[model samples]
Target: MDRALLNALFDEAVAKAQPELAVTRFLPAQPKGRTLVIGAGKASAQMAAALEKAWPGPIEGLVVTRYGYGQACERIEIVEAAHPVPDAAGLAAAKRIVDMVAGLSADDLVIALISGGGSSLLPAPADGLSFEDEQEINRQLLASGAPIGVMNLVRNQFSTIKGGRLAQAAYPAKVVTLVVSDVPGDDPALVASGPTLPLKGTRADARRFVELYRLDLPAAAIKLLASDENLAPQPDEAVFARNTSATIASAALSLEAAAALARQRGVESAILSDAIEGEAREVARVHAALAKEVAVRNRPFNKPVILLSGGETTVTLRGKGRGGRNGEFLLSLAIELDGVAGVTALAADTDGIDGSEDNAGAFVDGTSASRMRAAGIDPLAYLANNDAYTAFEAIGDLFVTGPTGTNVNDFRAILIR
Candidate 1:
């Protein structure tokens, strides 16, 4: 397996899903009156920029994205905020977004540029719940290893501007949402907690998750979850008549692009799944098994084949070590492979920031285990401590791409030769 070739394929996948390349074509038609472009997510700034470039008419609005993911937009304001964990900046930005949409006329339009990471990007706590309460909940959800969908369900219940509330606020006006899906199944409701879409999960579901994760919540937060008035608006509500959404980019598109690149290079390619979800290390174990089969038995396919997959994975933190799901997956796979020749892989987040880390992900070849062992790094120890980042960094295998201006989900590619 050529390392350079593997890296090239990953690059193609990331580039193909960029907001600038995928957003403009899905933009809604210009409205007759004022157009307010509100959004939140890692790719929202880029999405806003694309919308501004395509729309000839005057546009005004605001979008909050993770700190350092902001892109320049002349008409729309781009506010930088924290992600994976909510902060005061995100709370304020979310409040401002809700206020900006209030009192719209029937002829007005609201274009929501939603993407992955929006849940944490917009954290407007409900009436009773405070921003600190939302922040604590976010921290718990991330550390609990809950999938993105479940996390969003809990997040929306406590948000003042999520779970269709934005659309409810813009009632009587047209609301069109353009999304870059990063969650499994491409559920728009899970994309940034469905700010402009109807809620699919209920407060009871949120309570169940709180118990499942053993999270200690504030009394105000618990009370808000049980209140019917704070729940997401019903789908049958009259406000939904003018609400609509479209997925501009997604994990499937990026995975297909990577597979096409592999085929062009004379290698057979297979997309295992675009919605696989589980604990990061466990997912890596399954992929390592498949790679072993292809290399040793050639049962799945002949030699020189690449397997591609995309989805969000979770990491149940049992240690204080610093790492992301992508790195943790690679480290575990390297240990499982144990220097098996003719197998190499790369796992990365399309957004270029894996879990709260600086690197997109990491690379692991058959020699990865041996190299780490030689460097006095025990794979099992690091895996147990959730320290994959340091393990990969020591071997100079951390793959870092600052910010890709787009996010679909995790991308994993395995080459069996």
Candidate 2:
């Protein structure tokens, strides 16, 4: 258990999966016509910069990202905005982007760079819906423990630019989208509410998600769903005929990069899955079991194996928790391991922000509990209140990598020796 080695491995993994590096390989050849770039997400600014450097022709556009994620790009205007929750800055930017792409000619090229956090950073309320109304709904959905897919389904219905409408607005223009997927399935349509991919979810799916979560919605939202006028953009629509989208990076890619680093250091690694989801604590328990199995039996995999997984997980906030989902998961996993020898693990969000917390995530080794107790922090009590961040902070185990400028969702790697 070399902590320095673990940290270096995590850093290398993130570097390999960064948008600037991952996006360049997926970029299509420069189109013959004018390239109009419009994007929104935590990584859009960096992705836009990468595009400008790689594209041979002139590229002109505007992209919105989280406040601290901006990069220098002369061709693409970068706007910083609030994230996780929509604000006036994001609302105004979304409107401007929508307007910027509308009424382009057939020869023009529209490249939409989308990634995580775009849902809130590119907030554009649908007709008959106010920004405040949409903001309120976003807050409720986030707190309701709804999965990203369900939340995006509801968001797409209420958004003016989402669900392929952005591409629709640029009708007759060739649209090419390069996405860094943060969703579980890596579905382009689900990422950033499918602003470029064709929207396939029906009003029924949106209604069911709301009902399933028992989320209270405004009357205007309910009315909009009941009416047939504001459905999500469909595949059969003319706008999708010339549109092309590619998932440039994903959580699995990050995990694999981490594994490669581990292997180079004489460590064996296995990717459990890239789409693991569910309650954060429950998912931790499952991972803990697998780790114990590998450590004890050495059956499915030999010792010194690292189990990797990615994808977004949720937390059904029941207490006054001051922790992100990754922290919660690590706390639960530490409890389950209970000082089991030769096991070290890290769980973090690829975007460098985990569930509104400042830290990227937390790390837990076999002695994690011992270290916390030595610092006079009660790990169990903190876990009960979902305050894993405080617990990890006391022991200096919290991983803080301020705004990596790209997002591919959560990355979890467990080392069993």
Candidate 3:
């Protein structure tokens, strides 16, 4: 398969999943009174822009996006902040959002645009808890190798706005939430920690995660989690009676788009699964094994077929690596493929940023392993140091797309010819 075409297919998947394509279709009807738009996430700004374009009436709102993920919006205000980590900007934005939604009458409408990466972009420390305390816990949770559900369970308990509190704050106003899912199973509560969704989890679960991971958190955070007061609102709460939510985009949709493109190109494609979750390197090894089987024995399918998958993957971050999970997966797959011919692969985060790095991800082909060795770049060493970014950069295979203004988790493709 042509490498450029393979990369192009990956790009197609991302483009298909963009908010501009999916958001307009899921928009709610215009409210009778003023429309107040509010949201947070990597894709939220783009989602807001889409809303403004589709809505015929005047829209007033505020949304927070990752530092580089903000898009142009005519009516709604866009706030840029940090992602994968909470910052003062996020805290201020979160506070402003809560204030904006307060004291609204029944005629007012609240449009919430939520997506992945919002957990960090919309952080608000609970009462009696400091922003520094929340930041510390966020740092620990990210490094704990916990799944998104578990991490969000803990994070929601510490936030003043997450776990349906955003919707609760907009009580009396008809709230319609539009989401772009980036979690396994497309569970609404796990996306961006479910800022506008109901709380299905309990404070007990949050405390359990802290103990399970042996997280060292501030005394105030621990105390809040242990207490029953100020807990997240349940589904039965009256605020939820007027709430409506829709998932506008997700991993499954993007994966199908990629598979469709492959079929159009006269290449067979099989989407293994869109709900996959696990360690990045281990997941890559499994994909590599399947690709080898297809290339050598042709058990899964005939040659010239591409294997595609999408979902969120975690890295334990044992070493001080400079790469994200996508880069790590590519590096591991390369080592496992061991210079096998007629095999090419690409792995990247759909959001156009992997982990905390600038590059979306990396690529690997038949000669990648041997070329790295010849260039004195050891894959194992880089992997051990969690530095796949440098290893792939040395081979000139780092895939950089800047900010795509969309997020649905990771996209991986393995081509066997």
Q: Candidate 2: lDDT of 317?
A: 74
Error of 3 at 356 (Å): 1.0
Q: What's the lDDT for residue 60 in model 1?
A: 95
lDDT (Cα, tens digit) per residue for candidate 1, span 137-224: 8888888888887888888888878889989988888999999999998988789889899767777888899888887778887787
Our model 3 lands, by Cα RMSD against the true structure, at 1.3
Query: Comparing candidate 2 with candidate 3, which one achieves the higher lDDT?
Result: 3
Root-mean-square deviation of every model = 1.2, 1.6, 1.3
> Candidate 2: misplaced stretches above 4 Å?
373-376
Badly placed stretches (over 4 Å) of model 3 are none
User: Among these predicted structures, which one has the highest lDDT?
Assistant: 1
* Candidate 2 lDDT over residue span 1-417, tens digit each: 556666776777678767778777877766767889999898899999998888888889999999889999998999999988899999889989988988788888999999988999988888898888899999888778888888888888888788888888898889999998898979888888878776677888888888989888888888898788677778888768878888888877777888888889898888888888898999999999989999899968998788889888988777786888899899999889877998888888888988888999988988898888889977788888888998999898899989887888888888887
Residue 292 in model 1: lDDT: 96
Question: What is the Cα-based lDDT of residue 402 in candidate 3?
Answer: 91
Ranking by TM-score: 1, 3, 2
lDDT of each structure?
0.89, 0.86, 0.88
Model 1: residues with Cα > 4 Å off, grouped in runs: none
Q: Point out the worst 10-residue segment of candidate 2 by lDDT.
A: 1-10
Model 1: worst 10 consecutive residues (lDDT sum)? 225-234
